[model samples]
Target: MSAAERVPGQFTLVLHSHLPWLINHGRWPVGEEWLYQSWAHCYLPLQRILRRLADDGYTDQLSLGITPVLAAQLDDPAAVAGMYEWLADWQLRAMEAAIDDDPDRRASGHREYRAAAAALDDFAQHWQHGGSPAIRDLLSTSVMELLGGPLAHPFQPLLDPRLREFSLHEGLADAQLRWGTRPSGIWAPECAYTPGMESLYRDAGVSHFMVDGPTLHGDTALGRPVADSDVVAFGRDLTVSYRVWSPKSGYPGHGAYRDFHTYDHQTGFKPFRVTGKSVPPAAKKPYDPTLVDAAIDTHVDDFVACIRQRLIDESARLGRDALVVAAFDTELFGHWWHEGPIWLERVLRRLPEAGITVGTLATARRDGYVGDPVELADSSWGSGKDWRVWEGPQVAHLVQLNREVTDTALDSLDKRLPAHGSADPGADPRDLTADQILRETLMTVQSDWPFMVSKDTAAGYAQDRAYKHAHATREICTASDAGRDARAASLAAGWRRADNLFGALDARRLPTRDWSEK
Candidate 1:
């Protein structure tokens, strides 16, 4: 019998792929390195698995959200060239490690060398052009559904309404340009929501989106319509998701898995197994591929069982066929967990064989896995399941800066650009001053800065990025407001060279009135 016929419920996996604009930014600890590492380790490997699954005749196995900002970087010429260079450097380092003085380092180096070689070949064969073609190919195969989000992945619940609408429209448009399809669903930046945003989503032609389970008051057995709108809000099932990625417990922490933190300082390779929770880096055992194979098999079985049990339980509890969604950041696979991609492919393949139905969020919605309309409160997937992470006292200064910059940019554009009904408002699509102001403003409002600051992961870098963009926005707006056209043009040009993404952004389309106040 088919999996859907055997099971009383369905399961959907969502992987959100995102990174703030990083090209021309700093490298090393917190910049382009992030883009290259995730590209090489996570995106490449994950897509390969999806491609194989498609060949094996799988369709709608999961939903993949690629933020427009990340998409822009993925398809950018400069970023594409830089990623290739980074992969070449990775191969060189692996070769150096293969010939290291220490036996453990040499063993790790050989493993890394082969992996690097494979990655280089994959890039040359598929990703050399840019991420769009590779992503488009996957979409064309129907292996997964693509989810789009607003420009720069801003916290929409806190964003000004006009900017919120503008960002989403532009983001969907950007996706259409790249993949020739506009996503009807979004990952909803941070899975954050506030009252009345659903109307804006409906207006933008979005049909479905995601939120934390708590945002739906923990009733996650099905998607819910938000506040009388036809748009559906799918909540992540914490029961299944936390099994693989909670703060304290997860499959990646298993003793036999490769330790992501314990690096070989000499060769910059992670050369040790987790061994034990209490074990120090120096006391950890050398990584063994054989151990990882067994560990992955064990975890795959455990996860498959967990999903099967949950589906059965939820179906019985609801007195109807239920839906389960497990969403996580794409970087968790291969990049952070090391064995994540293998585990993912195995779980996806095994679930259906085990009498469990696996499908994408869109499938769940279309197949009648929807419940009642929910009056969702302000919520996010952040700490406390609230907006504190992006609006807390820790990031009070950033919050203030975002508001100030947004206002300055909006006020300047209002004065400079013609209104919607004015004479030939579309006369020029190239408003360098307005374009640059909006660009900087969008960068300033990205949810990453506040998230990093609240979590204290590279807080300094996050703070610097937020303030730097805010400062740029203010300066350009000031120059344009003062009729210093040349100065404003030069500043906009300089900033454009450094922080260029979203080539389709036009300030003329921004709403003249602040709709949030209404």
Candidate 2:
């Protein structure tokens, strides 16, 4: 809209890739193995898009945050094994369909079989063969910037202090193991934050993080620098993000986009497009990806314009280049909205040509830009872009449990700190039992649980995850203090069996600095 903004500079585009650790777990209704589906549809295809861009000499400056739990599953031997098993199974299913007798049915089945076989093969080479190192190659390619977060995607404000520390430390360490090094920016698991959390980030070496625009109040359009710490907090440019996939009325809601729900019972494939806004699922058109590609181009153009405008206004208002970061769950591109990969490819490809400069979060901070904080209110990137999704009535039990378990862990850890005031320096003070319970507690407190429950997707599993972890966290804190080591150990072991995730969380990896150099 303005000539000043067009004087080509840098803008940040951060995308968060996260999923509950559903490796060999979660089935059917709630689970749907969104992981591999997301990988095939979104992750691998998106990676290919980035590769294509790189090939054309257009390296990505886009920021990508992958949660540690998700990372762990990505790097796990079990998960890798399971993925291949699933792919082979899919190949077999496709073969069966290809041999169907009916003419029309056979043609459809043959087409699907070919697509499935292609996807399975792509996944093998792109991800499975080399493991997560392939992901590291992408990040290291100068085409993309990577971000990390807590071990599990937890509701941070309501997590045990020890768990928070443990998770972040282990999470960052896991990133180093898989993708080759630590990330200077973190996604902060659902964009959940509290007053003191920034200090933890400072302690852990994270210099930047992102939150929804509403969380920073209605004032700022771009990311702002926070007080008490140097960590820059980027806010999601929702107006742009929603152009492709908003909850109610984004392009994905159009008649031509693929339907996330309503899978073909016989093939476990979603064979239709939205085809109608208010129409029932039974009456949708067959999904034609070709039509969706044309729609993506139009929507993507509008998004670039929106970001360019935001950068112009913010740079002038804040007296420097301002970053307009549009963040979203990585799953949306392919897993949730079937044609998301197409939209993503179109957006990324069109950015440079549109004269919109995209840079990584770390690069944005390094290049010098800051926002004076007026105030930051409670918020999130949820339905209203607020906390209601995690605190609403549909998740009241989760709310109560979060409060009790988190507060209990905090109080217990506080009391234990005094004992370490003069303790031996080399002692293993990392509370393993507390850490384990807190890990489960943190994993269970993921905002996804409440959101999933609210949306009625396996509400019971969500409830059970939250409550069971809350119980373990509370019981461990109580039992440990009472010298009930046996009971504490029993509870910790039990929770590990049920809420197990990120087995690589060795206590040795915890960062020891308080407020010094991260």
Candidate 3:
């Protein structure tokens, strides 16, 4: 078929990349390791794929949401240095594994050694400086539309209105500083939303954001502008998204796929395939990279077919060209499912060949695929399609904790620092103290804590992080109140160095008054 005679619908691949501020916090099994693993396995490889596409002249082929918190870590000098060391150590570990006693272990070790070496080479070549340069290059080429989010990945629904507005503006400013262009789209953290947030997004210069499929009452074939707001909310096409990864089953569950849960104890490498659902990790079959190649091919075919059929069906139903947005967490690609990057590359390349118009969310909007306006209820991408995960009985305390911390941080900042329009604008000591308090407060209100607690995954560590940030906020505020400027400065500097994600944050820009009053 000629390009002009192809299907009428468009397909958008949206990947939300995020991780909480984990630098200088903890190392193995939970904190910095998570960052390094995702960086090495997901970010580096994904960018490599995108760069190849860009080299071939793919423009706005996909939309990538890099939350401000994640971007800060990627651009941090200390984090970059640490990641280099981690990659070097990974190479060494692979070398040791190649000399193991068992034949299967040795074979797996050799394979991993090659991968580790390649990753090291890639890091030195493209990422030795920091991730910002590479990310900026991608944006410049227009290979992908960058989607920026709030300062920290806070649950916007439960956060105070003033703090929410502040985070949105600051987050966009950070992205603009790094990329030299402000994003018109965002992947709202967790795809969570409340009524009236669209106006805030419009005010912040965001033209579009995402929510879950069910959030649109299961009619997610096209983007819908919320009531009386030009800012559009794109609903994730769950039918198409779950084909790649879902809670119950998906391509990542294939028997030939590397088992994410099964790892070589000594080498810290995943050495086995999923093998069987009931099989123990020790009993699982050894991983074979060759087997995964065939599986990726099959999954790629399956996924492309699914997307093609969905677009056709939805276009027919809508009586016009429709849009199918398949959104997922970026980490799921190379971090959770080892073959995900390969599958992604194949699917992206194959879709265009099949005569499907593949483009980013921005392209979809610009092409006039928006549907009738709708008033969306409060919802999220979590289970139940509501706020139960972050606000349920299991995480009620965290909800309250977020409230208290936000209130305290804003109240203290107002009391100690000059108001927004005050004349004392040039490098005041009060501004420094207030900035630290706001930083700690933002860190404390990250949505990861309640999410981890609700899922019972690393509950202890999540609780510790939340309490740690909250305590830092309280201590710094207390010192400032007592006129202990030196002590407060010391505490603030230490916390800043420890969890310094957003270096561009300035407390003076935060709204001192409520949004309602404005």
The numbered model that scores best in TM-score is: 1
Q: In model 2, which regions exceed 4 Å deviation?
A: 1-7, 101-107, 129-131, 160-162, 219-221, 305-322, 406-418, 421-426, 429-435, 470-500, 504-518
Per-residue lDDT tens digits of candidate 2, residues 383-500?
6766677788778877887777766765655544434422343465555675575576666667778888888877787777667667767878898788787888787787777544
Each prediction's RMSD to truth: 1.7, 4.4, 1.9
True lDDT of residue 163, candidate 1: 87
- Alpha carbon lDDT of each predicted model: 0.90, 0.71, 0.89
Q: Per lDDT, what order, best first?
A: 1, 3, 2
Model 1 spans > 4 angstroms off: 1-5, 421-429, 514-518
What's the distance in Å from true for residue 487, model 1?
A: 2.1
Candidate 2 yields a Cα-based lDDT of 0.71
Pick by lDDT: which candidate is best?
1
User: Candidate 2 has what TM-score?
Assistant: 0.85
**Which pairs of residues collide in model 1?**
none
lDDT by residue (319-356, candidate 3, tens digit) is 99999999989999999999999999988899988889
TM-score of candidate 1 against the unseen true structure: 0.97
Candidate 1: residue 354 Cα off by (Å): 0.8
